[model samples]
Target: MLKHKCLDQCIACTACTVQCPVTAAAREFAGPKMVGPALERFRLFDQDIEISADYCTNCKNCDITCPSSVPVSLFSTLAKAQYRRQNGKSLRDWILVNGEMFARLASPVASFANITMNNAVVRTMLRAVGIADRPLPKYAEKNFYRQFAELKQQRFPDKVVFFPGCYIGYNDPRVGMDLVAILQASRYEVIVPDVVCCGTPAVANGYLELAEEKARRNLRELRRWAREGWPIVTCCTSCGLTLRQEYCELFRANGADEVASQHYDAGEFLLEMLEQGRLNSEFIPLAGKYLYHAPCHLRAQGIGLPSLELLQSIPGCEVNVADAGCCGIAGSYGFKKDKYDIAMKIGERLFTKIKDSQADMVVTECGTCRIQIEYATGVKAVHPVSLFKQALRFDWVG
Candidate 1:
């Protein structure tokens, strides 16, 4: 639906404004309902575009909070793309949008690049180009796709396809490896297909055309796997949201609805397995209470807190839900130097909650969220899948 069409659903509710984290963090940001659906009402009359739309992190907080089911973030993103096309974009936009290309380039210099990017000179240059000064996620020695080929697992008749998003594939292949270990434990053959980067960062950065192209490729792969009776799963919350909802909501990619229906967040998939009495309930005890921060995108899926619930179920574990809100690193929003302050301010609650709790460590499903947590709070953060594999002492991979 167009912005005009979505505007008709609103009855002037202020709920979105009240719940908007960006608005709370950066006072200048016109909160969701106004900059999003409300501004669309003006666009219906062919008015000028909304400049405030660019400030939206596209976190879908408005969509999640809307009582009227308005696609609030869609309007903002569409407007953003339209504005970008008219005014052109920055070089940083090009780099940030093509997440896969950047990951590939960084892979070759993985170790040195990680060390180099931490310096004042590099950070000064990055800030000039709109990138933040903070330490970015380091590229892994090998991406998940390359690492997948190197792992030897016990094969089984049952099969499942795993979509290792750019973050998991490039920054943290261990999480991907952990999921593989757990799947092998469940006696299922893991299939790693040629899926694109879900194009979430692309869409968020206003590269709508590139995002659609990436989505089309992923859709084709997802359809093929679905046809062969392979259930698709993902560990990254943003990637899963892009595959399962954003493609349809933002880009309107062909066959996206079907692909979305066949998708599952990895933790949610495991919870389903638990309910079905098929999960491998082996013994190994993790002796401490861990804090679990649910990413906004995962909550936007409306699937409840699967990772937190699953962690709590472990006999030797206690999972404490963080007393916080959004982590503020919504895709690449926080990576821009201009927006870094807002992201940090928005995340202060979460960082404080982590410090106050003083849990042994922090765990979250989103890779960016994990990075933000570790960067801000100096607490070791990881994907629950990694924790699961380590706690269970799964011998296949660490």
Candidate 2:
């Protein structure tokens, strides 16, 4: 019940509402200004919360757009959590929020899980429970931790701890491998820590207490490495944002400030190495035009398009910033039946732009953003770190 001081900074500028993609796409939404700061005033007085707060995708566009640095999305997210506490949450939300549990249970029988997940009967059953009709991200046969256990890596004096998060650890282990290769080539030993999900899924789904539990668990390990001077890195922008911003902002997690100070997006970390004249420059020319989509979470970090900047460093690489705005996935937000259409509607502008660009590939830092891009536009989407790894090793097969 700790009230945020950010709520006091709202000046009724309406800039947040103007930049709110959800408000623009879905007319039913009361806009971030009204649902967030405005309703927060009543909530502080123990008044009933408005239902419109649930429409917020928690994409953080409002946070990025606020001139006064008001955390509009935080307010909306908390309201959603409080409302759920009173009314109770659905089974669909319970399943969606516990990503780490699902990943661990499914990874052992990945092929069967993947096949069963897409079957008509399973899809129908899932849809009946309010899961979306869209395709789900397939589970990897071997999760990132298992793959990394068998990985042969050269030891370096300079080491960095990597938080793979659930997406890379469960669905796409290859991205993690690519990141390891990239870091190794730059003479840094990669350390994959034993950490839980960054708890974004829980926070977004109104499980605030669960998110705090996760934050504390992760901070125990992350804060240790952070204090030891090993830079903590994550390839997923959402994970980065949650660890560096949300843990402190929403949960007031202890040692979050220290961990946030050391946390960096993989590309952001590499970009810093480049700026400091320490990044490996042995990358061969990679000739391809890639359209890059900046995830709303990455933008919310207030770091200027680090992945886009990193990708541009490759010789002969033509990287264009799509700048079309949010992909609208917002982690598990798009996977709910009720929010799926709204998510797609919010992404229409970006989808249209990608289809017209006809780039060799679409690159981004968020796993869900890549999924949405490919599903909506029929374009292959990959993480920026994967492309950088290819460029570094001259491994482009095309």
Best-matching candidate per lDDT: 2
Give residue 2's error in model 2 in angstroms: 7.3
lDDT (Cα atoms) of all candidates against the true structure: 0.85, 0.88
| Candidate 2: residue 237 lDDT (0-100) | 88
| Per-model root-mean-square deviation over C-alphas | 1.7, 2.1
Candidate 2, residue 116: CA error in Å? 0.8
lDDT of 2 by residue, 154-236 (tens): 88999999999999999998998888877776788999888999999988877998989999999998898999988999999
* Candidate 2 pairs with clashing backbones: none
Backbone Cα, N, C clashes tallied per candidate: 0, 0
**Lowest-sum lDDT 10-residue window in model 1:** 389-398
State the lDDT of candidate 1 residue by residue for 1-398, as single tens digits.
Answer: 46556688887888988888998988778888887777776765658565788888988888899998888888778788888988898888787887788788888788887888787888888788889877788899877777888888788989988999898888899899889888888888899888878888888877899988999998887887776667889999998898889888866777788778888899998888878978775657778879999999998999999988778767788789995989998879989888999999999999999999989899999999988999999999989988876666444542
